[model samples]
Target: MNVDFVDSAAVQDLLDRASGVRTEGGDARIKAITRDLIEAVMRAIVKYDIDESEFWRAITFFQNGAPEFGLIAPGVGIEHFLDLYMDAKDADAGLTGGTPRTIEGPLYVEGAPLVEGEVNLTDDADDTGTLIMNGSVRGPDGEPVGNAIVHVWHANSKGFYSHFDPTGEQTPFNNRRRIRVDSDGRYSFRSRMPNGYSVPPGGATDRLMSTLGRHGNRPAHVHFFIEAPGYRTLTTQINFGDDPFAADDFAFGTREGLLPVPNRQGDSASIAFDFRLQRATTEKDEGFSSRTRATA
Candidate 1:
């Protein structure tokens, strides 16, 4: 029997062979995940009757656009999907009554300059809309959680992030900083309102999105990575409700109770919100922070 074409049996045999290749340690976790993913992909190809040329084209696209995959995750809703999964696990473990966790976009950079209680994120001469965001960190029991570090970062007026922009390397951590809460768990910062941005034009992500009849545009928002001792880190964002794309975010990040109503006065605006953190029960969770834990 000469079987030259790729079929169910042939796919399974190939997958089995590929799964057998591993390091000297023979990591069970990686091997298992690889095998499972192979099976899923094989099933998709067979079910969809995906042609060889189309599949190879997709492979090429992914290979060239590997870096942009992080930015693409939100558009595909993978970040929100994981948030729902984590919420379910927390509920099962009796974790509740805290600030909601949201998607942490791909632009986070570690080692932002630390400040005591307040800092100005934008350059003094830069003219974007002035905004003052104030908040307090509290435990789930409603007690203040002092000394918590609130790392904040956002895009500039032109919808460009500090480290990811073309000239970003020069100013490395511009528009990004870390502020520790006061003794009463209060934290505040001065920054200009950031605007929404689209996927990089002429990039692999933009090309794929164009083919799909979709636009990769996120709403204006501020990113926050809050971490305190004795609590799990919370990675979230504050979406600006006034943006035209606020309710129609391509990333699906906008959610109920997450958008704050700003108070406008003269040239400055203010938003007051509170964050409640859940207690960490394990040693691994003790030093938890929203660093590289997120997939996207």
Candidate 2:
């Protein structure tokens, strides 16, 4: 038997009151969005025939570990969809070109020490193979765009990021650097190669991935935040073409132009990839978004 109170006047009244449709105390935009979301949830509940036990179990899952929802978002492509949506909007506005933007996978930390031209992202004693990355920031027209800030971060050899490593061995901002582009827009760094990693074992993301017939694995990759005055800030990353998950990234972070093959030599590898920026038409386009981020 099917239940159908989703369209009932009683349910609609309840939703209106619950969403604060009559209240003008808070942000009007937030209220409207909330109301619409609540309605959508109700519709889904009916469409999927979600039973009470299943719904309560989901509630309990969040109650136990809400932070896992952040991981789950990227694991299920919600984060990537946002980047794609923005790209579509840009295309509609005839704003295309430059490095493709991708999800900023909830791992970035603020306040890395600024450096001039070049820096070493790894300590001398680490036995991991060296990664030499040389690159320049250029405009869409191929001219060097100096005065840019390149914030870079990546996982270690074991695919664990600083400040988030459960092993408790990484120092603050390890393998992270903020390199200021020189007058020629050139920046380089030598670091250890990062490996691909799976999600926390048996955790929320893993559990959902299992049920959805998917895996929560990401390729070995490097992240970058490139911003220059008067140019749109680029949030993008490059995936190693050799990684098994490079093309099948769970977060959907890999793009066609962002995958670079590593050129290997004895005990070291090098990758050459230049970044491009586009002129900003408005001040808002020159800055990062206001998403909640970690700062240290």
Candidate 3:
């Protein structure tokens, strides 16, 4: 059967009506995207000799399987569309440059204890080694952002995050905290150094890494998420100053400015770091909601 003879004009009419019907407030952008997608499909059909069956197959694959694939697309840069848009807006408004933003991993949980000055994050462990992380949350102009809320979390000595470990206790999320910076914009915490850990080892992410001949070992580092009223939220990691893989994090999140200097002595160590945050200009730049209390 000659499906092309069914009329391209009628197909286009149906697409146009579908786009109009799906439109809503703030949907002018969506309509434009829909028009572009339809135009691209029409062009592909004509230029690439894509038959009706092939076109329908592509649509079916996207409809049935794309959502699951989309969840992991951010790891490969496809999810940067929103970040790119925000970056452009920030550049236009002169709200640029402090520390580059990175993707938040799947392990962030909220509602750890709110400690005063510092808390030994590894209090349960028997290791006597102490790590003190102190930093000032500064704005783009180099001014301190006082009273900022800084959330810190990391894998324990065994490279396992709380809530994700099946053998762990079910209390408030483990190895996490919401520390408020003092008037001097300084906050500190104590936690034992973490050891490197591999990825899930058999999951889809691990499968891809194996095919690429890569190891999924993440180096020892502490995770920090800082948010203040007028400052843009910062999600970053502080790499152990002397870890072997400090220069090459599995997640590729290592930045020159993020590595702090470690002060190590007999069974004790401390690290001091200063964090700089960008000023938030719009409401869209506000920090995300906390998920710490939701952990089982």
- Clashes (backbone N, CA, C under 3 Å), per candidate, total 0, 0, 4
The predicted structure with the larger lDDT, 2 or 3, is 2
Tell me, by TM-score, which candidate is best.
Answer: 2
Off by over 4 Å in 3: 1-89, 126-128, 169-171, 266-268, 289-296
* TM-score of every candidate: 0.89, 0.95, 0.71
Ranking by lDDT: 2, 1, 3
Residue 200 lDDT in candidate 2 = 88
Q: Over 4 Å off in model 2, which ranges?
A: 1-4
In the range 180-277, model 3's lDDT, one tens digit per residue, is 88888888877766666776656554555576666566667787888888877887677775777777555665566767657888656778788888
Candidate 2 lDDT, tens digit per residue, 1-296?
23367678898889878988887698888888998898888888888889999999988877775777668888888989999899999999999899999888888889988887568887524567889999899998998988999999999988888878898888879888899989999999989877788888988888888889999999989999999999999999999998899989988999989999899886578999899999999999999999888786
Candidate 3: residue 52 Cα off by (Å) = 15
Q: Can you write out model 1's per-residue Cα lDDT over 82-111, one digit (the tens) per residue?
A: 889988998998888778888887888878
Q: Tell how far residue 126 is off in model 3, in angstroms.
A: 5.4
Clashing pairs in 2: none
Tell me which of candidates 2 and 3 scores higher on TM-score.
2
In candidate 2 the C-alpha lDDT for residue 194 amounts to: 79
User: How far is 30's C-alpha from truth in model 1 (Å)?
Assistant: 1.5
